[model samples]
Each structure stands twice: as C-alpha cells, then as structure tokens.
Target: MGLESAVSLYDQSTRGRAGERRAPGAGARPLRPHAAGDRSVGFAEVRDFHVEVARRADPALALVPLLVGGDPSKRGKVIAASADLRSRGLVPGMGMVEALDRAAEARWVPTDMRRAREQSGLLRAAVRREVGAVEIEGLAGFYLCAPADREEALAVARRLEARVAEQMGLPLRVGVAPARFAASLVAEDAGRSGARVVVAEDFEQYLLAQPIDRLPGAGPKTAARLAELGATDIPSLRRLGLDRLEVLLGNHGRSLWLLACGQDPKPLRVRRHPTTLSREESFAGDERDPGELGAVLVRLSERLEQALQRDGLRAGRIALRLTYADERTVTRSHSFDAPVSAVRELAVAARALLDRIDLGPDSVRRAGLVLRGLEISGAEDRQLDLF
Candidate 1:
C-alpha cells in the first residue's frame, strides 16, 4: 500500500480505539485506558529528522555541521541542528546570527517542511505495518500503544529502527517502556537511532538517575524553579511526595511527582489532527470568575470550530489548561464519545473540564484549549446531530 493510504488507514482505525468511537447519546462515554507497566508501549523517534532529510538531498552535508532554518539575511531561529552543530552549543530557537558567530563554517539551510512531512508519513507507515494502531507525534515521533508483550515491543522497535535505516535512509531512535513518559525518556539518550528497552521493575531507578529537568512537561522554567527549591533531581522530587509537591507547584506537580516515581499514567494518544491545535487567552489581570472563563471558552471554542471546519476535520479529544496568578498551571483532558466540531459541543466540553478544577480564591490568569485525535469530517456520523 502507498504511504498516504497506510497512514490514513492506521489513523482512521486508531481514532475509533483511542477515543471510544461511539454515537454521542445517553450513557455514552469515552474510555481512556490506563494500562499496566508490562503492557509494552513503544517510542520510535526519528533522529535528526530535518537535518537527515537535508543530508539525503545533499550527500556531502552528512558529516558537516548543519543548521536548519533561514539564511543569514532572512530573520529566523535555528529550528534543528546536526549532532556536530548541537555539540558546539547551537540549539533550536537560537538566532541565526549567534549560530553563525559560534560556527563560521556552519551550513545553514531552511527546513523543508514538505519533505519532512513526506518522510514522517513513510516512517509512520513502516511502524503501522507491524503494529495495528500508531500515533504520530510531531514530525518524527511515532508512538504505539500496547504493542503486546515486552519482547514483541523490543522486536518491533528493532525492526522499525532497521526499516527506517534501509527504506527511508533515516535513523530512528527506539525505546520501549511500560508507559509513554518513560518510553519517550529512554529514547532521549544521546546517540543515533539506538534502542533501549526499559525493564518495568528497574524503571524507577532508571528514571531517578536521569536529571529532574528531563521530566516531560517540566520545561526549562519549571526546572529552574525546582532547582531553586533544592529539588534538583527525580529522587528529591519523589521525596517531596504528591501532597507537598501540590503545595509547591499546584496540581501540575502531582503529575511531575508521578514521573519521579515512574507512575505516569498518561496515555499515548492517537494523532487525531494533522496538526495539534491550541487556543489560549491570557488576561491582563487575574480573572477568577467561572462565568467569565466560560465566556472565554465559548470564544476559544468558536475559533477551534473554525479551524476544524477549515481543515474539514473533527476533534475526538480535548484538553483544558489554566495558568493561575501564581504561575502554577493545571491541565485536564477528556475524550468525547465521538468527534466534535460544533462550537456548542466544544464549549460544553471545555466548561465541563473547567468545572473539575478547584480554583478556590486563586485567580486564573490564563486559560487554553487543545484539541487532538483529528479525523476527516463526513467520514463517519459520530453523533445523531448535525452542525
């Protein structure tokens, strides 16, 4: 089968399984599963996806220090860099001028998104050929949920790594773990397209040995704050416990604490949208009124509905996030019984998620909505209603 057809087929099948495919009606609820640690989840991350594509186009650029972005004259940040360039302190988001200063002979090239997408689709197809359901993350990450036993997961990862090397001429670093977070972390080990199968029992120590800053969702800002608090590693954060961490960083800390102990239950979501869409509104001042936030949700949902309409897509899963006045953010998500594209349905889901949180007197400074698990509209009648 063609790459597009294979990816589209896997994408359609996963939409049903990832977010319960059911007619929207009474007693219908989307089931988000929490698999045990032994249920192998795989992470296949394409190493140097953009740079590798560029290298393939020009063979000589293989061993050279390369940066993907805009030319020196045109203003653009470094989007991706080769191992040699990154070793020289060139990171994504760095200015082109700074990069040039660091490496005078660096070959700066603009990333070809078209080629990236094409190569990514082929990689997804390769993984889907072995595993039934596949989730596309960004341009290079393909996650397979519950790919059977641990041995099967490892075998699939090895096969995928070799397949990409032979077929696409792109290297894919593979990791198999009991959960999504750990698997993704294991794949981050510095090297080209290596494979690491994290044992479920030994995962906690493996997780602790890694720096605290490596925790997913804990960005540079969060890491800096954690460092300031003297919790500079996973073990330190685990020592703080969930209740204390909650006091320190609000409810977001709860998830981080779980990561410290290797208990992250975050599921590997199916890529429902061609591109993940997020809409955020930051107030000039802290705003705590639920009614006011509900109004904002309506506007955001209207915007989300327009994007879905423009793309001829529907979102089966939605995530709600709020940043409080103290800068501590909390997020929650729900998968719908069926894909939703209407403003009213989106707003309803948004508010329902908002209601699940306790703001107390802490005013919310920001609110956002992220829609995922997109599928082509008119492909299936999810609900009995029409927009």
Candidate 2:
C-alpha cells in the first residue's frame, strides 16, 4: 500500500489495536546501549487522541467521519478531524467551513476541553508513575528523559504504552533519541510500531531520511519558501548550507539547519502547577445595582482567601472582571504593598478595584475575582494592622 494510504489506515484504526499494515521505518535498526549517564529524550504521542476520546465518550461517534470544534454555523476553526480527513491535509486551525467543504458528510461537535483536561491529567499521572518527570506538549503528547540503558528505556516505553492503554484506553507511540526534536520526529515516524529508538550513531542517516514536514516549526510557508530555493526534502535542504539557509530564512533558517543536522540542544520543560487562581459567577438577571454586585465581590473574595489559606499561599495582586449582559468583558486590577492572605485584605483590595470600574448603562451579567503573583506563605501575623 502507498505511504499515505498506510498512514490514513493507521489513523482510522483507533480501537487500541495496531494498524494492519506498517510503513517502512525511518531507522529500523535495534537500539544499542550508549555510555552511562547519556540522557536520551523520548517523546510519546497518543495517536488520534481527540477522536479516540470522543469515541470512547459516545460510541455512537464511531465508524463515521467526525469533526470536533465550534458550531458549524458559528465562526471557529476545526480542533480535530478524522484520520482520513487529516491524511488529506485537514489539520487543526483550519476554518470549520473549509473543513466541512472537504468532508461534507462528517459529523461536527463542539470541543469538550474540560473532559480533555481530565483525561490529560490521567495520562500524565500514568506516565509519571513510570518516569518521575514529564513535559506535556498538549493533551496528547509528552516528552521525558529515559534511562541511559537502551533496554531499560525500551522497557519503560513499552510499560507506558500498556499502562495508558489499560488505564485511559488510549494507544501510545514512542520514539527515543539523543535530542528532543529528533525524538519527536522518530515518534511521529514510529506510526503503528509502538516505539522507535535511534542512537547517536544513526541520528544523521535517520534524520536525513525524514521528509521536510517532519522538521519542527517548518509549516506550509516554510515549505513553500524552501521549495522556492529548490529544496524539497531534508537532504536537498541540507545542501543549501548554513550560510545560504541563514541568509534565506534568517534566524529560523539557522534553527532548521540545526535540526536538519540532527542537533537539538533544547531541554525538556517539566510541567508546573498553576500560578494564578480565579473564581467567577454569572448573575441570573440583568443586575445593575452596585450594592448587590459589591456583595457578590465580597463573597468571591472570601472564597479566594479560603483557597489561599488552604494552599498556604498569599496573593500579591488582585483583579476583578465584569461581564456585561451584551457579552462584553472588562477587567481592573490592584497590586498590594505586600502579599496578602486574609479575607479582610482580599475583600478590601477587591472592593477598591471594583470601585474603579464604571458600570455604565450595560447591566452586569457576571463577576469574577482573580488572585495573581502567588507565593508560599512564610508565617502568619494575625495581629498585623492594615488600616
């Protein structure tokens, strides 16, 4: 079968089973162990993650072309598409109307970000149990450093695939290489094989074999520009040399050349917890009374104070957001002289900011409170006077 057909076929097979046909591997050789302490960056991508999740949530979505994003009648882009559509170059961020034009019979659904976030957390937790630290690219892809021992790294990848499959019902494909970019490429090319590992020695040939689209950050525009330079694939593009590429594409050209040479010194960015906390509530009717809105702000501030105390954190800045009945939103903020964690301090600051915004003729529909610049509380001074 052709490469496109093979990829489309695998993309369509989202039931936790391997593709019936496998494409030729980029670098199919078995992985050999490197020197001890050599860090190997590995990337794991859940194949057809959005489609698979939607299917699991509602089995009725199976065996049909599916499009997940905004309402078709509204102005929005496509968030995810079926494998066959994607194989035909229907990617995320394309206009929904254009996407519908391509897949006329496809079913469209709104994005379920809340559910996607929950599933992503579960996926991360499963991988974290196998490997201590991981950097998630999005809801579906993850980057991690594996053991120096090639066999052990392969075992970790296998275990991760099995763990996610059993726990989250998602299939995982992994690729291990000396650097993050190459590893990502390897993982993409791994396809239905589950995992592909490339040692430093084979990095050059393996990278050379990849197509131009595999290069990170090189979108259709870059491809068109490269085509203008008579460079169609990785090898031809490399012939352009660093000087010519830099001259042609500027700093971005330099980055492309580095990846073309299998040199990606970038490090994994481990995921961190949220730095800001916010609470919001929508009013039932068009409530324009200042006293009523101020009361709501006070309640929200108290809730914020309780949350800060529970987390042992203090906020250095407070913000208020008001959503008008016409759907227009406005925000105002104030910074404190020092971090504050008490309900009195939060309410005082929130009320002061709320006073700054003019309600105008628009009736208020929602009020929100946000605490920013958070830091761990050092000690409690209940006796300190703010007045």
Every candidate's lDDT: 0.76, 0.76
Query: On a 0 to 1 TM-score scale, where does candidate 1 land against the true structure?
Result: 0.61
Error of 2 at 134 (Å): 2.3
Please count the clashing residue pairs in each candidate, in the order shown. Answer: 3, 0
Give one digit per residue, the lDDT tens place, for model 1 in 25-65.
11323222233544767788887788988999899998889
Q: Rate residue 243 of model 2 by lDDT.
A: 56
Error of 1 at 264 (Å): 2.4
Cα-based RMSD of the predictions, in order? 18.7, 13.0
**Poorly placed runs, candidate 2 (over 4 Å):** 1-37, 271-387
Report how far off residue 299 is in candidate 1 (Å): 35
Q: Considering every candidate listed, which one attains the maximal TM-score?
A: 2
